[model samples]
Target: MNIQEYIESGILEQYALGELDDAQRAQVERMATEHPEVQAELEDVQRALNAYGEAHALTPPPGMKERVLANWQAAIQSEPGQAPAAPATEPVVRQLTPPRSEPAAAEIAPSRVSWSMAAAVALLLLSAAANLVFYNKWKQAENDLAVAQNQQASLASTMQAVNKNLTYRNQELAVLRSEQFKTVALLGTPAAPDARARVLYNPTTKAVYLDVRKLPAPPSGKQYQLWALDQGKPVDAGTLAAATVAGDSLQQMKDIASAQAFAMTVENEGGSPTPTLSTMTVLGKM
Candidate 1:
């Protein structure tokens, strides 16, 4: 098969994941040996996957190695024709002896010790590498878990904010339906013909519910300002940020009294001292 077809067959991914059957694995190994490009690509995929696995590895439970070694020794002892098992508390060491007659005294001791030390150092290095790899994998998994937890917390916070807003709006709607309350619909102005708002005023409780759902998002460094107006002169009710624009409803001001009408205008953040007539979006009479 061509390289593209070979890659598209999904065998490479399986090989990287160590899921291939023995026959398929042998074939891939043979091919990798024969083709340098194939070998390079295989190595790249394997390295990437290994890195990912390492990044998400979990620590093995303690005492596992001891358990594994104990089982192995038990199995070895149970084998037919095997030597008798050694005592559990006794230390066992295997010694290698060279033929003594022709060997020089100086060469024998140093060479043997040197070879043994070299073997020990090599084993130590391999063990260290393995331990480092395992540690890195465990740390990576912990970091990933922490990040996932943080994301879940952020989503929960957002949901709580939404729920709180919904509860507040429902309470306002309930008050508006009461006998002592007055409802007023605000029509869109010439500056923004598609926009509209509503005001539910409770005279008994002196609360005003202003819904500015239809208003557009204000420009950067600007905000939507609500005005409680009497005879064209305006009183600052509240200022709304861009986040309030796309939501279903907004509770801009509460506990308002002695206002004849309500109006909205686009103005600087924290609102202007008075409504900017030219930028007015909605107007309503109570």
Candidate 2:
């Protein structure tokens, strides 16, 4: 639909030369009617064709007129007695040769050259149009490939997220359904009324699992630690971050046995040897 490209397309030239088929000619006609530039270009091409034909116009031979006149007089004299008389000898075949003349040879040379020029122009235009078609097709293919790649990447991300969630859920189910594990809840303290955590413990193996369900993320360079109280003394149960992420719930912590209570406290990066009672965010007595 690019007018400039269409204008330079040489379709007008082909139209002037009467080289295009009916459908193509109709299409060019529609274009010419709709676009003034196309119409003007068609007129220009027509004028050029006319100019070429005039410049190379061929004339009849000098003997051609005399020969035709002689034939006509002989026929008239023979036919005077009766109706139009037949020729004494009928011509067997028509002549296909052109008259020999210097002017005619010059005219023929120009005509042949013009034909070659027209053919070359037409061939060049066809090549250009074909290239445009192939270019458009190549661009469409590239766009389709890009869309497919994006869709595939999106599908891959979705699958990865689903698998991660499934893995987390399976781990949770394993701990929840096991008879050897016991569940414990850490209620929010007065210091952090909204904080809460859960613990899963196996008494036989002293394995501990911590899930911080509702707790604020620890400040930079600080972490949360768990302590098990046995005989009124604090024991290092485990350490973990205070933040929770999707597909990540329970964190494995140090094991404990024979604990009377479990508590969580916020401390510096490595954690303290003893519990910071004032910072205790949650506590649950077994």
Best by TM-score: 2
lDDT at 166, model 1: 79
| Candidate 2 per-residue lDDT over residues 189-239, each given as its tens digit | 998898888888888989888877787677778778889888999998867
Cα lDDT of candidate 2 equals 0.81
For model 1, residues 87-194, the per-residue Cα lDDT tens digits are 552333212322232244548799899999999999999999999999999999999999999999999999999899779878866775677778778888988888
Which ten contiguous residues of candidate 2 have the minimum total lDDT?
89-98
Candidate 2 regions off by >4 Å?
A: 1-109, 217-221, 245-248
The stretch of ten residues in a row with the least summed lDDT in candidate 1 is 93-102
**lDDT (Cα, 0-100) at 216 in candidate 1:** 70
- List per-prediction Cα lDDT, in the order shown: 0.78, 0.81
Using all chains and alpha carbons, the TM-scores for the candidates as numbered come to: 0.45, 0.57
Question: Given candidate 2, what's the lDDT at residue 50?
Answer: 97
